[model samples]
Target: MGSLTLSGRTALVTGAGRGIGRAIAIRLAGEGALVTVHYGRNTKAADEVVTAIRAAGGSAFALRAELGEPGDVEALWDGYDRQVVEHTDDTGLDILVNNAGINVRCAIGDTSPETFDEMFAVNVRAPFFVAQRALERMRDGGRIVNVSSGAARMAFPEITAYSMTKGAIDTFSRTLAQALGPRGITVNSVSPGIVDTDINAAWLRGDEEVRQAAAEVSALGRIGRPEDVADVVAFLTSDAARWVTGQVIDASGGSRL
Candidate 1:
């Protein structure tokens, strides 16, 4: 329905069942990319996304794989491969968005070893392996966008472990871009701040004071919408960003500026 900049391309977006990932999947489909919507366990939600895309005259399919679990990456690819063959008669990917992650609201003092490990496994290990597998199926000029967070740059004691994981992702994006440059693949990370999604609903919704406080953190003086970050990701995946790689684009509405 838009410019169709990514027409005929194939994309896979992890954690696409809801939130920012959902928005990214839809946006990519709108741009004319056949999208694979990866979900952890929400079959209904994932199906809804695919249906929405199809209803909009775009192509999409849902894949289920719980990230951070054993053999998760392999399972995800297996499903993707099957779908690709069925839909496009090909096996290579044009875009991969590592957007699935979990947050643990705990300071160092309150963080246990189990908590730390789980956070890293889901937030860091999952994306690392997912990308590793994706590269095998990615075209030479493919795009890889890792979803990081502004917490990685700021001192967010409330989510210390979560921030640490995002730091690792930022490093991964930069280093991977250097390694994949020769192959014409561009890798980048996006950092969003205080987005208004179900993930933040518990703290940001139904409370005017809390909502205003969060909005005030950004120079824009308003909370971010999922589409805000989704648009940035859409840009990075397009040919317009062919020369932009190994960078972390802040989609935080100037938070902490």
Candidate 2:
């Protein structure tokens, strides 16, 4: 909030209707970016995020794209083109945040093939294609932040499929960063630990034992807030991280260290 780090930039954040995605959208808007809040099914939540940004004197809009399905990337950009034309008349985007994902808790023994496929479809396939298509519309020197999970590095046997998907994301970011480096584009992954969002509220809030157990996983001795990860993403998108790319920045509060 001190300086308009992203002033005049246009950002697209997927799965922004709630949870960590919502926090990133708000944070980027606060830094003066024109944000497009993308949601899959929760139109009401998406609208609320737009409303909150507008109320804060920021520019924002909402778009929908059900990721992991056929033509999902195309549908997303179709909306993006119209919105950008109506709002800024700019043809290029400055920031792309792949924050839309799903996690299913299932151990390897009980994991179904269908569940594994769906996880890869949404978490890995969707984001990969989204970046591929977005490259056509992304301006030089743009930033792309892929939302990964600490589970990629740490062992989460209960959610093996989800963890595997995140590992794919980390690799995608690293490889894409090199591919886009000549154009001044930076691609990086931000891996966050357990955050106190609606997604984790079931076990993170109002349950003293559960909350404490989760907190103890991190060196910080507390569960992460949405804003905690948001701030890290904002920094990566800003000029401050201009030289940083092809790296996985773990925003996990020094877990297991």
lDDT of each: 0.94, 0.93
Report model 2's TM-score to 2 decimal places. Answer: 0.97
> Which regions of candidate 1 deviate over 4 angstroms?
1-4
Model 2 C-alpha lDDT per residue in residues 1-257, reported as the tens digit of each score: 33338999999999999989999999999999999999999999999999999999999999998999998999999989988878897769999999999988899998999999999999999999999999999999999999999999999899999999999999999999999999999999999998888877766798899999899999999989889999999999999899899999999998876
Per-residue CA lDDT of model 1 for 192-234, tens digit only, reads: 9999988888878989999999999999999999899999999
Clashing residue pairs, backbone N/CA/C < 3 A, model 2 = none
List all candidate RMSDs to the true structure. Answer: 1.8, 1.6
Clashes of 2: 0
Instruction: Give the distance in Å from residue 234's predicted Cα in candidate 1 to where it truly belongs.
Output: 0.6
